[model samples]
Target: MPKLTSQQQYNIEQVAATMAIEDMPLTERAYKHLVQQATGEKTADQIAEEIKKEYQNG
Candidate 1:
């Protein structure tokens, strides 16, 4: 994995903290996807399209 900037790290930490407080169960794949979105490696539209494709394929 590539090194994340401070802002990306902070973003991910915030998400983790919120999930912890909410008692949410985050899978490793979900965590990685969140990191990708948080870091701007994937845009919301892109993610939505991927989800659409996955749903359609399945």
Candidate 2:
């Protein structure tokens, strides 16, 4: 994965902190994957489908 800028890294860290307190929290690694998917070339629909497939299989 490409390196994130300082601001980007800080933003993701903040998001990670927020999600940590949620009822169903994702690991930091999972949040990193999410950031990657959101910034990647695929359309939103494609990303959504990928998440859905993973959820079903998981």
Clashing pairs in 1: none
> TM-scores, in order shown?
0.73, 0.58
Q: Residues 10-47, candidate 1: write the lDDT tens digits.
A: 88878888888899867787777777787778987888
Question: C-alpha displacement of 26 in model 2, angstroms?
Answer: 2.7
- Clashing residue pairs found in predicted model 2: none
Candidate 2 lDDT tens digits, 1-58? 6666787677777777787767557775567576675456455577678879989999
Candidate 1 stretches with Cα past 4 Å from truth are none
Candidate 1 residue 2 C-alpha distance from true site, Å: 2.5
